[model samples]
Target chain A: MTVTMEDVAREAGVSRALVSIVFRDVEGASTATRERVREVADRLGYRPDQRARQLGRRRTRLVGVTYAVHLPFHGELVEALYAAAAPTGWDVMLSPVTARRDETTAVESLLDHRCEAVVLLGPSLPSRALDLLFARVPTVVVARSVPRRTVQVVRTDDAAGARAATEHLRSLGHRRIALVDGGRAPGAAERRRGYRAAMRAGGLDDVALVPGGPTEHDGEAAGEALLATSPRPTAVLAFNDDCAMGLLNTVRGAGVRVPSDLSVVGYDDTAVAGLRAVSLTTVGQDPDALAHLAVTRAIALAEGDAASAEQVVPPHLVVRSTTAPPP
Target chain B: MTVTMEDVAREAGVSRALVSIVFRDVEGASTATRERVREVADRLGYRPDQRARQLGRRRTRLVGVTYAVHLPFHGELVEALYAAAAPTGWDVMLSPVTARRDETTAVESLLDHRCEAVVLLGPSLPSRALDLLFARVPTVVVARSVPRRTVQVVRTDDAAGARAATEHLRSLGHRRIALVDGGRAPGAAERRRGYRAAMRAGGLDDVALVPGGPTEHDGEAAGEALLATSPRPTAVLAFNDDCAMGLLNTVRGAGVRVPSDLSVVGYDDTAVAGLRAVSLTTVGQDPDALAHLAVTRAIALAEGDAASAEQVVPPHLVVRSTTAPPP
Candidate 1:
């Protein structure tokens, strides 16, 4: 059984109203009485319910966020969210969707905290749940496409990003380029569409799509599988920077030189891609634009503006040392 | 500017108790009345106070967590914390401390959610603030040492871990080993102490301590500086895996082969260290053990168990491709 305010009141020989006033930090409570009430509450393991207090307030000034802890690119976007929220006098509360916890658990906690609005990054929730969530709170979904006008959305043009990466590799005179797929990740299917379109555009008859997940291990496995083929691809475009790093390292470990033997391109252009040693050719998502749009839309909805908006930003190719004319 | 339940009651011509029951999803309200009240509430943008309802309950079953979003190693430990909290039937609420958001903001949000206790990972708060926080709730500090008996603590033996890394390099016929510092991070000072003690114990008179920070860029800078010396050190032990990766990549980019020209060792054998592409030799902190102890201690303290325990776990070395007999 949990301790209650009533229990604390009884223990401290005070009325429940007095205990409530003290817990709320109101001026009605005297100092000695406040100290005594706090001591009694602490002894009884009682905490004043914060959500209850929030109900009586005019504004929460809080933006609920859902992000994956393991995704490096997600971390960058979250930092950007803080900056965007700062000027608007809004603070962010993060609820991480980890391997052990599902997205529902994460989102529910945000609702329980009475966050004014929500921002989801690369959310994997079903459309129905997302719809329900948006209906419950002002929501802005980032880096994924949902039905138009269902809720606000800010996403990169993933297909264009993939196409640019493929075209860059093709322009380097590489005929065979493989794409390490992101599996069923938010932008995976769109990126695949872009890759295929670009391959056909370049007049390449053969297109290879390797099975891969979002992690570095998946990229390593994909690299190994691609290398074992009778006719290896001359270049590879990975799912993201992490997968790209895995593929790049695997090939280099097998005594194959990067760019000189096999050119590689990664997506997301994360911090890792720009590392002096990794210097990967990749596609870039405009985080600043994405952050600005998401925050603006979220705050608008929270303030009861109730206008649904959808914005798609283009991704650009970042040419680094990872690509070269195929050997 | 927020709508209250009283406003909803007046709009729907219902009693306050009826409105509360409808919002709470409890009995004593007809379907027609519930719908009417809900419609009015929605129109008014009124959300029921969840925290107020929670005040009547015994347990939130929540453990608040504070972490740095950008730290990859911190992500690993958070995953471990979730797993550790699972069997105990507790859920975690995360508040990320990003570049734009300070630790105080993160911690206060946790308290607002009425979490039973707080678990801080690599917190950078002042000692006085930490003391004040612990006084307010059951707290467990990880990866940083605090005054004994003030609060429960679970951290790796940093000095020992650093000493072990130094000794391992020394045993590999490397007399000129330098320490790349983590500046003033949680475990940096202790690790530096261990490095110095180990260097002195190894009978090496000339010890090199390089100025480094916790990021990969800092490591890269230190690597470049070290390499510019007339007779560069044979081996370098970096502040953490990020810094080590920075140093390793810098040297490798400059055509200095690992284990042949410059052997590198990183700390905190993070997920990155185990990647085949970056098989870094580093010290391992048992995240599972640390997580289990921290959660257990936190729950106990929350339950009013007054016993204060401080535990220091051992750090072991994992030999990988980054380190070998120095040339």
Candidate 2:
């Protein structure tokens, strides 16, 4: 009555070898063949044995990554992760979930793939979801703050980065400054906190905080709103470069001169920040270091290292032509 | 004796069930167990019979994609491809290969994965590569021209787009113009041919062609070269938006004003072209439409549809604030 590879293969109309290949996740079998083999095995009430397999091998050498944010910078992070992991003979597989898919579903999907360890980038998953994932697999969270003792966390200092931006503007003698904030974004709350703290620290507590989203469109809307204020702020610190670029465009379209009439600063020095046309002043996070640390920590946890609660990375500023003294 | 799942399970010291899960590529097994199973199987010289397994199942709904270009726009294209294909019950698996990997090797890698069909993005592979691939599996190419009679091709109309850009500037009373050409890029030859033909057709063969590359750095270099020219051309047409953004930055740094002193036009109306700061006058190609077409054609080929040699999509131009009459 026990299910056999032959039984499943026969039901799926494939040879036992083909079924084995599909199960092994080896290259050479077409995607169609793999899908068919998995379906047939599932139908035949088949299950794979794990404890024996582990005893036979030293390591799985597979890392799973789940990313909720698809910003262009994430692509760079993914590339960096590949570079960091590849030399160590580890392969990274990505499973991306949109807003519609909850964190549990995403984590479960990675678990389904038997990922040795999982990394969640800017995850919006609840704390319970993190606890569940920690119980099932070695889990690492990037840019998410979780109080659970079981999970490992890696994050850039968003609050500090925000404060740096605000201070940079304040040092330029801009009294009436504004922050185009990333409203309800993953790291928005921490960034807002940083901005508030910095404003107070710099004795510019009256600085405006404008609500915005993560996209360039939101930046434009925020820029338009800021322009409507009775006394326009001389300097603006945007949530990120995308928003800054949007704000730049909207302000320029309204015939405002940059660095003379208005000085703009952005965050996350993406490739666009360095573009000749944009040349945005912004905050920089070492994406390469962040990726390397996440993967190395994930591997350590997979190898049975005790989990740590947090890994915090410092932030720095990259000044270009976007900010100037108020005229 | 032919290698068996029992042998793999036994070697791995995992239960047959664990081996099955690992081999099936299912979710439940831990990463450690899956790696072990695969390692043991590899050591035992196991090769799964993919064709046999596929015959058992009606079809495997997986598509394989190999991206040769790493530009951000290419990432967007890949994303679009995934979005277009996912709705049809198909999932995409990526095969990471370097530019050094020849077309034959690339195709072989896909074959090893048993991809139902393959999509090559901006492949550097020659026509013979397409011939070799068509022999084993159905294939579609994006942004590459292949002379093979059997392989399907999808590309944007680079020539027409270039013409529109040239005409736009000419109509705005710009007599002295220059082109920052993308030398030896995949579509560069077509774009260059388009630019030359358009200039000749408009009775303006005196325009300069400055050699360039695909990167923003290249654009900066081109901008420097153009600036050094005597009575510098009133307008410059860059290879793409990235290059244009770079040139714009470089020229602006040199104290030249866009539109008033020097008009700049770019190709590939990617998301960058629309940013408020970089309101580039650019040639537009519908990436969504192109992605939809590429996926639809790829699926058709996988379903055994008769293969055609090539498919071309038209390109248009979007006039933003970057272009104006010469001062």
Candidate 3:
């Protein structure tokens, strides 16, 4: 027969209440009693009934993280979060909110698991849905910023990153700069706003903005569009590294030399940017640092410290082989 | 006072047993009764006390997945598993096991959360640890082949995939081919055996074997080593896509043209392989299909279908711009 908590208490020569307190690690149980109970329980091969304990405690210590689509760097961030949370005795659960599955269902499904907190990465959920989710659990929104103050936000400063990219190009004497805008993606809007703000601030507001997506194909399309322009921008600022790669290949395929014919800048200095073949100049965000901050803030909120609601992380530019002064 | 199950039952004009059966969606509950209970609960704004219900069932419908390291593709597989399991009313929890935290601690931590089953992805644990895990709960092993008959196994046909990669190179007029090996990884041994068998079968047993790892840096190092050989290999088969990319970059950096000076083949046609810039010739394993199969099989095992212990999925090769006739 399977052993019970009562059996464990009898084996340890302790009262059932003491055994309960020790197993639960609740206050009022002395360290000596706790250690003794654990020793006897280990010797007896006793494991607390998880369901019973969870019911009594009313918390799961499980947090749900949802991503809109599958991207490699996004996966890296999730891995970082997992590494950060594991040491804190919390586990992260994944839920992919695809177009087929609406945001409400995703949030409801996580709620059903009794997760004490949630972290949404590049979520497709509308603001109302986010408001509803925040009402249900302590939530940390990553890679996206919402207007509400109820939810905590953790994101790389896209506007500042974009400005740095523009200023880098300007410093290289590239007066004719082009922006490949990532249309309607979670971070795209903020990035676009940053690019525009930076261009205007740098007296380059006349620079063209080409509509694009986050994929390399978008970069290719943007390259084609730029090539057709009467006077192609000597330099291009792509949406992200993937898009920059697309632009690089497209330009190279057309016999255009990088940094000689056209300088290019990418964002999210992913592994691809540092590749010897692709040596892309891009903006870098420390995923590990961001993940640590988000998870730490989440634990605090889960532990009932709800006053801290927002945190912003800074981004920096990494110079590589892809950028040079315009000829 | 917070509303209880009894309060919900009274409000719905149903017995407490009927309310529970309806909420749990037990097989015995009729559709009409289920609909009535749900409507009443919704109207009364009654949210089921998840903790209390979790206690009664002794199952959280949560499955914990543990990974030794966070490789890019592992993230895709985890996301796929989450998407697959969430629809079936099961949530996928992640436990990132580090060198500091052993497999036993990770497994026990999941057990403490009342996970219905556990899946270990590319675990580095010894067979004895695996045996202990399987004894505790329904367990599934992914990307690893274990000798134990009790634990269920889900893995790609790496041997077959490697054989196909080698044959593809041989068929393309490549006589001097080298295999960049993934040393000591779970599936690496099997893949190495396959490559050797295929080379011998093709009457090319004289081919070189270069030691490597799953990372791009490893690929670059292998490329340097191959370049040092007297008659450098005209064709290279890398351990995986990331490694292949590294090799491509390193060779190109040394002024070698891909498919002209060296034809390259990669294993695991990940999303990066499909990128226009990479266009990597590699082996393809359907991550979504594998994840779906693993989760379904795990749930079945947890639900008392312990008869089947192993399931194998086939791998296919995808030819892209990277492979051609040897110089």
Predicted candidate 2 versus true structure: per-residue lDDT over A1-327, tens digit per residue: 345677988898888778777877778799988888898887776644322233234344668887643466666666677678877766676665544445565566555445789988877777787787787678888875665446888888899999898899899898888989888776787888898999899888686889897788889999899899868999998988888878887887788889899999998898888875667899998877888889999999988888765888988999999899998
List the candidates ranked by TM-score, beginning with the highest. 3, 1, 2
Ranking by DockQ: 3, 1, 2
Model 2's DockQ score: 0.12
Work out candidate 2's RMSD over C-alphas: 11.1
Candidate 3 residues A1-327, lDDT tens each? 346789888988889899998876779788888898889889887887665665566677878777654565666677688788878977676665654566666767677666778888877677777877787688888887787557888889888898899999988888888999988776787788887887888888667888877888888888888788868899999999988878877777677888899999999898788866668899998788889988888888888995575677899999999899998
DockQ of each: 0.36, 0.12, 0.44
Question: What residue runs in model 3 are displaced by over 4 Å at the alpha carbon?
Answer: A1-4, A24-32, A82-91, A98-102, A148-150, A275-277, A296-309, B1-4, B26-33, B45-51, B60-62, B82-91, B97-105, B147-150, B304-309
* lDDT, candidate 1, A217-318, per-residue tens: 888998898889758999999998888888877887788888899999998988878877678899999887898899999999888895665789999999
Score every model by TM-score.
0.79, 0.75, 0.90
Model 1 chain B worst lDDT window (10 residues): B49-58
Ranking according to lDDT, highest score first: 1, 3, 2
Which CAPRI quality tier does the interface of model 3 achieve? acceptable
lDDT of each: 0.86, 0.78, 0.81
Candidate number with the higher DockQ (1 or 2): 1
Q: Over 4 Å off in model 1, which ranges? A: A1-50, A58-62, A87-91, A114-117, A128-139, A146-152, A229-231, A299-309, B1-50, B57-63, B86-91, B111-117, B132-139, B147-152, B299-309
Q: Is candidate 2 or candidate 3 better by lDDT?
A: 3
lDDT for position A134 in model 3: 82
